[model samples]
Target: MADAEALTPRVFIARHGETEWAKNGRHTGKTDIELTPYGIKQVHTSAKELVGAKKLLDPARLAHVFVSPRIRAQQTFHLLFEGANSVPDESVTVTEDIAEWDYGDYEGLKTAEIHALRKSRGLDAERPWSIWKDGSEGGESPEQIAERLDRLIAQIRDIQRPAMKGEKAADVVVVAHGHILRVFAKRWLNCPVDLPVDMVLPPGGIGILSYKNNNVNEPAIQIGIALPVTD
Candidate 1:
C-alpha cells in the first residue's frame, strides 16, 4: 500500500492582501476595494516563495481554484500566479460564496464603533457583540454564512475525494477575505460557524487543510507547511 500522506490532497486558503479599509481595521463587506501598494508588494513576495514547482502551492499540481468576487481577492490570485506557466483559466472559478462577511449597517465600522452603534440602538445591552454569535445587524446571520460555505465545501470535497486516491491532481486553492476564510476553515472541519473560530488569517497569509491518515472522512488543519518568517 502507498503511504497515506502521499495520497492525501491539500486545500490552500489564501487571504487577500491588505486594502485601505483592511489596514484601517474597518468592516469592508460588499465594498469592492483594490489592494494597497504595500499590499501588492506583500503578495508579490509571497508568490515568489510559495507558488512554484516543489513549493507549498505548485500551480502545476493545482486541480482547481476558487476566488472571491471582490477585487482585492482577484488581484491577489493574479499576483500569486503572475508568471507561473501552470494554472489555466479553465481551472479557476470566481465566486461570491467566498466573499467577505456581510457587515450591512455596521459596514466601515471598527469593532469598537460597531459595539457603540449596537449599544445606541439598544442591541447587545446585556452582553458584548460577537459577530460569530450575534452577527451583524441587517446583514447575514451565522446560518446564512454557513449555508453558502457548506455548499462550496461540499463541491470541493467531491473534487478532492477522487484525488485522494491518486486518480487526479490534488491541490486546491481558495482566495478570499480574512473573516470568510476563517469561517471556511471551521466549516471544512465541520465546526459550527456560530462559535468563535479562534483562528486568524492575516492579509497575504496562507493556510492549509487536508484529510488525516489519508482518510477523506477526517479533515484537519495542516500546521507545519512552512517556517514562520521572523522580522
Candidate 2:
C-alpha cells in the first residue's frame, strides 16, 4: 500500500493566512499585504498538524512548493515550513501565476462596494456582478486567468509525471490567495474558467488534488481528509 501510494502524485493547495483587507472583505488583488497576527498564529497551528512525516504534506514526499508572489502567501509558506528540514530550498518557487486574481478596478473594495460602483457607472442593471463570470475590469479576464493557470498546470504535470513511474518525489504544495487557488482547483479538473466555481476556502485553509485511480490524466479533488482542529 505504501509503495502503491508513492506511485501516485498529489497537489496540496493552501490559501494564505488572512490580511486586514481580507478580514474586511476586500478584493485585495495586486495589493501586497502581510498576514495579521492571528493569521500567523493559525497558520502555525495548522502547520504543526498538517505538515510533517506521514502527515498530509510530508516534506519528504514534496516535489515542489509553489508560492504566490504576494507577501501574505510568502509569509504563510514560511510559517508552514518553519522548522522543516527535508524540503530543499531549490524546490520552492515564487510565482505570479498563483497570485490573487487581478481585481484592477475593485482592488481593496468589498463586494457590495464593487456592485455599487458598477451600478453608479450604469453597469450590472440586469444582473449582479460576479468575479468568476465577468472578471475584473481593467484587469485579467477569465481567458487570461485560464491561460496562466493552464501553463502552471502543465508545469505541475511535468513534475508529477516522473512520480507515476516511481522516479522522483510525487507530492506538491501550492501556497496562494483564495480566489486564484479556487480557480486553480477548478482548472485542475479542466473546468471552464468563466463558469461559476462554487467553492469556499477560508483563510489558512487546506485542500487536496490528486489523480483518479492513480492515473495522471484523471485529475480529481480530494474532498475529505482528517486534520487536527485548532481551538
Candidate 3:
C-alpha cells in the first residue's frame, strides 16, 4: 500500500477549449462542433502547462478519464493527453453523463437572445433568466441535472475512497463543457444547484476537487485558477 498522504485522490475537471459558438456566448448543448484552430492550440498549451511532473495534474497519477461526447470535448481531451505517458485508450470513457446541459429550445441561442425570447413569451419578466433556477425549456430541469451529477459524484467517491486508503493512484480527469463542469464542481462540494456559482471556467481551464483532511467526507473544490504553461 502506498502512503495514505501520497494516495489522496482528486478529480480534475477540464473545460474544453473554445468553439465558434462558445466564443460567441451561444448555448452549445448536444451539438457536435469541432474546436477552432485557436481552441486546439489553447488545449495543447494547457496540456503542456498543467499536466505532467510537478504540475497541477501529474499524468502518472491519473487512473481514469471521463469525457463528454461532444466533438469539442473529445478534441480537447485528445489534445490535453497528447503528451501524457502510459495513459491507456481504454481508460478514457466518453460519457453523456458529463455532456453539456441539454439546452433544448434555448440551444444555439445566446443569453441575450434567450432573454429576449423569454420576454416575448411573457416568461420570468420579473427576474433575470437563470439556468440554475429555471433550466432550459424542452430540456433538463435542475433536479434532473442534480440527480445525474449526484450519481456521478457518488461513483467518483467510490473510486477514490479506496485510493485514499493507499491502494492505488486515484486521480481522475473529466473533460467536458463549461456549464456542466462548473455544476460538477459545485456539486462536488455538496452545494445546492440553486445557488449562484461565482467561479469562472475559461476555455481549456482546469479546476481541481479533492478531499480535505484526506477523507472522503471532506470534499472541496480548490480555489485559484490554473493558468496554461508557456514554453
Candidate 4:
C-alpha cells in the first residue's frame, strides 16, 4: 500500500487578479476584461511565491491545469505559470466548466445596487439577495453551479487517482474567478452549497484542496497562505 502522504492528490485554485469591475465591486461575469496593471503585478508576485522548486506548488508535480475561458483568468494563468519550466503548454486545458458564475442581469452591478434593484422589483424585501440562494435572474442557480463543479471534481479525481499510484505527479491546478472558485471550494469539501461561506480568496490568492489521510473519501481544504520568507 502507498503511504498516506504519497497517494494524496491536491487541487490548487488561484483566483484571477483584479479587474476594473472587480476593483469597483461590480459583478464581472461573461463579459471579458483584462487585468489591471496592479492586477498583473499581484499575480506575478503570487507566481513567485507559490510556484517553482520547493514551493507550495512544485511545477514538476502538476499533472493537469484547468483554466477558465475569461480573459482575466486566462491572463492570470499565464502569469502564474510563466516561469514554470516544467509545465508544458499541452498540459493546460481551457474549460468553460471552470468559468465564472453567469451573473446574467446582475452583471456589472454591485451587491448594493442589486439589492436596490431587487427592492424596486419587490424581491427579497426582508433579506439581502444572495447569489448562493437567490441566484441571478436568467443565470445559473446554486444547484446548477454545484452540479457543474461536482462534475469537474469527479474528473479531477479520475485523473489524479491513477497517477497517485505511480511515479507521476497528480496535482491539478485551476485558474478561475472568485465566486465560482469559492463555491467550488465549498463543494470540494462536500459542504452544502447554500451555506454562507466566510472564506475569502482575494485577487491572485491561492487556495488548496487535498484529501485528508491520503483518503479520497475525506477531502479537506488546507487553510493558510504561502508567503515569501524574509530575513
Candidate 5:
C-alpha cells in the first residue's frame, strides 16, 4: 500500500471583499454589486496572506487561479492579485459556476427591509421564513444552493485529476462570493449542506481544502476556512 500522505492537493478559496450590501448584512444574491473602499483594502490583505504562503506555493506552481465572473468576485481577485486597477494574465479567468447564489425575486433587498415587507403582509420573517430554508419570494433555498455546489465540486475533481493535467494534478485558487464559499466548505467536508448555516464569513476571508485520500467508500477531504478580520 502507498504511504498515507502524498496524494492530496491543497485548494485555496477566498470570498470577495465586502460590497455595500455585504457590509450591512443584506442578502446580496445575484446583485452583481461592486466592492466598497474598505472591501478593496480587505482583498489586498487577503492577497498578502497568499504572498506569504509563497514558500509552499510558488507563483508558477499556482497551476490554476479562477474567480466568479460576477463583478464583486472578479474584482476581489483583481485587487488581491493585481490591485484591481488593471487586469493581469495571472488572474484573468473567471468562471460562472462559482457565482453567488441566485436570489430570484430577492435581488437587491436587505434582510431588514425584506423582514419589514413581510411584517406589512403579516408574514413571518423569523427562522423558517428566512431565505435559507423556505426561501424568499422566488428564490432558491439553501438546499438548492447545495446542489449547485455539489455540481461544481464534481467539476473540480475532473479538473484537478492528474490525468486531466496530462500527468500532474492541477492545483488552484478560487475567488468567489461569501455564502457560496462557506457552503462549499461544508460540502467538501462531507458535512450536511445546511450545516454551514452556522458558518460566518467576513469580506476577503479564506477557506482551504485538500483531498485526504481516495478509498473504497469515499474520498477523504480536509477543509480549513479562515475567518480573519483584515482591514
Candidate 6:
C-alpha cells in the first residue's frame, strides 16, 4: 500500500506588500492601500518561493488559489502568478470573509489616540487588540468576525475536500491582508479566534499553513512552508 502519509493537503499564505499606512504604525482596516515600489519587487520574490514549493505539490492536487478581494491582495497575486510555473483554471478568488478587521469608529485613528479615548473610560489602554469582544465603539465584535471566519474556512475546506480525498488535490495558496489572514489562521485551526492576529508583512512576506494530520488547536501548528520574516 502507498504511504498513508501521502494523503494530506497543504495551504500556502501570502501577505500583501507595503503600503503608505503600513510603513507607519497605523490601523489599516478597510483602507484601500496600494503597494509601494519595494512591495512590487517583494511580491515577485514571493511568487518564486511559491513556485519552488511546487516541487512538493501535485499540480492536479492543488485545489485552487484563494485571495482576498482587496486591491492590494489582488495585485499581489496577479504579480506573483506571473512567476508561477503552472497555470490554474481559476486563479485568484476573493472572499469577504477574509477582509481586515473593522475598526469602525476608529478606522484610521492611531493606537495612541485610541488609547487616550479608552483611558478616559478607565479601560486597559495597553490592550488595543484585546477589545475584539467589545469591539470599537462602532466596530465589529470578535465573536462576529470569528463566526464568519469559521464559516469561510468551512466553505474552503468543503471545496477542497473532494480533491483532498482523491489523493491528488492536496493544497492551495491564498493572498490576503495581515490581520484577517492571521485571524483566519486562528479560526482555521479551531482556536479561540481571540488573537490580535499580529503579523508583520514585509513587502511580500510569504508563509505556509497546513491541516495535515496535526492538531490545529496546538500553539505550534504554525509551521513554515517558506521562511517567515524574523523581524
lDDT of 5 by residue, 1-231 (tens): 132333345567778887888877778877778999999988887666654333332344455676788888878776666632333375446666678877776677777777777777787845435555556667777777778777877766766665332245455677898767877777766676555357666788766676544331244434443332345
Q: Give the number of the best model, judged by lDDT.
A: 1
Local accuracy of candidate 3 as per-residue lDDT tens digits, 140-164? 9888888888988888888888777
Candidate 6: which stretches are off by over 4 Å? 1-7, 52-61, 83-91, 120-133, 195-203, 214-222, 226-231
> Model 3 off-target regions past 4 Å?
1-6, 83-86, 224-231
Q: Is candidate 4 or candidate 6 better by lDDT?
A: 4
| Model 4: per-residue Cα lDDT over 1-231, one tens digit each | 335554467899999999999999999999999999999999999888778876778788788999999999999988988744447878898988899999988999999999988898899967788898988988888898999999999989888767544357889999999999999999988887787758799999988898776666778887754433435
Quantify all predictions' global Cα lDDT against the true fold.
0.87, 0.86, 0.84, 0.86, 0.66, 0.66
> Which model is ahead, 1 or 3, in terms of lDDT?
1
lDDT of 6 by residue, 129-170 (tens): 455456676777888889777777776676656554344565
Best by TM-score: 1
Q: Per-candidate RMSD vs. true structure?
A: 3.4, 3.2, 3.4, 3.0, 5.5, 5.1
- For candidate 1, report its TM-score: 0.94
Which portions of model 2 miss their true places by more than 4 Å?
1-7, 226-231
User: How are the candidates ranked when ordered by TM-score, highest leading?
Assistant: 1, 2, 4, 3, 6, 5
Which stretches of model 5 miss by more than 4 angstroms? 1-7, 52-57, 83-93, 119-127, 163-169, 213-231
> What are the clashing pairs of model 2?
none
Model 1 per-residue lDDT tens digits across residues 20-96: 99999999999999999999988888888888876767777788999999999999999998775448899999998
Q: In order, how many clashes per candidate?
A: 0, 0, 0, 0, 0, 4
